[model samples]
Target: MKLYIKYMVSLRCKMLVKEELTKLGLGYASLNLGMVETMGEITHEKRVQLKNNLLKSGLELLDDKKSILIEKIKNVVVEMIHHTDEIPKINYSGYLSEKLGYDYTYLSNTFSEVKGITIQHYIIKHKIERVKELLLYDELNLTEIAYKLHYSSSAHLSNQFKKVTGLTPSYFKKLKEKRTQNLENL
Candidate 1:
């Protein structure tokens, strides 16, 4: 049985889900962000228990197809931005279409209808957020961050960053540093 879960975005969330499944004595074939493949069929009573347990830990079991597809889209984007080092070579439309076995047009329309934002815009938002995280880490320079996130150039990254955040990457980095310094001073 394949089950879809909501709010399963982080590695810590995955660990918690795994622990819960183990605690329930359910054997899972695989557990990915927002999805789990069970080795055996789950009884209704057990499913209800699993749902209750996951809810206690801030996760929700999804049953609706649209919600499941939306979660799949989110999981794909989240994995691309937060978990992977290499961006896919293809454009996001093609990537998502191929991954989800739907036409790009259909997926785009569904995403926009459901999310109230274009998928491209959602991707840009995630990319900018990822840039913020990398900036806070202080491990990669602007140029490297640009390349890592598949931005065309450092200037391109800077332009988008400024457009989205009203601050340059350098300014954001400086703000992060200042916050760190103040926290340490306390």
Candidate 2:
């Protein structure tokens, strides 16, 4: 049996799920972001218990096809941006289509209908959040950050950052530094 889970976005979440499954004596064949394959069919009572256990840890079991698909889309993008070292060279629509085995048009329509935002806009939002994370690290320069995130140029990145955040990356970095200094002073 396969199960889809919401908010299972990080490695720590996977660990928590595995721990819960072990405690329940459920054997799982494999686990992936937003998905798990069990070694055997689960009983309704056990499923209920599992659901309640997962809820305590802030995860939800999903049975709806549309919700599962949406969570798969989100997991793919989040894994690429936050967990991986390099962004793929292909365009996002094509990438998503190929990765998810659906027509790009269908995927776009479903994502827009369900998410209330275009898939492109969702990617941009995730990219901006990733940029904010890298900026906070203070490890990579703007040019490097742009390249790592697959932006065409630092100028493009700066423009987009300013558009989304209403502040330049440099200003963001300075604010982080000031906040760190304040924390240290305490």
RMSD of 1: 1.2
Model 1: per-residue Cα lDDT over 32-123, one tens digit each: 99999999999999999999999999999999888888889989999988899988999998999889999989888888888899989989
Report the C-alpha lDDT of model 2 over 1-186, residue by residue, as the tens digit.
999999999999999999999999999999988889999999999999999999999999998988988998999999889899978899988888899999989888998999999888888899999999999988899999999999999999999999989999999999999998999999
- TM-scores of all candidate predictions against the true structure: 0.95, 0.95
- Give candidates' CA RMSD values in order: 1.2, 1.1
Candidate 1 overall Cα lDDT vs. reference? 0.93
Window of ten residues with lowest summed lDDT in model 1: 106-115
Lowest lDDT sum, 10 consecutive residues, model 2, at: 86-95
Tell me, by TM-score, which candidate is best.
2
Clashes of 2: 0
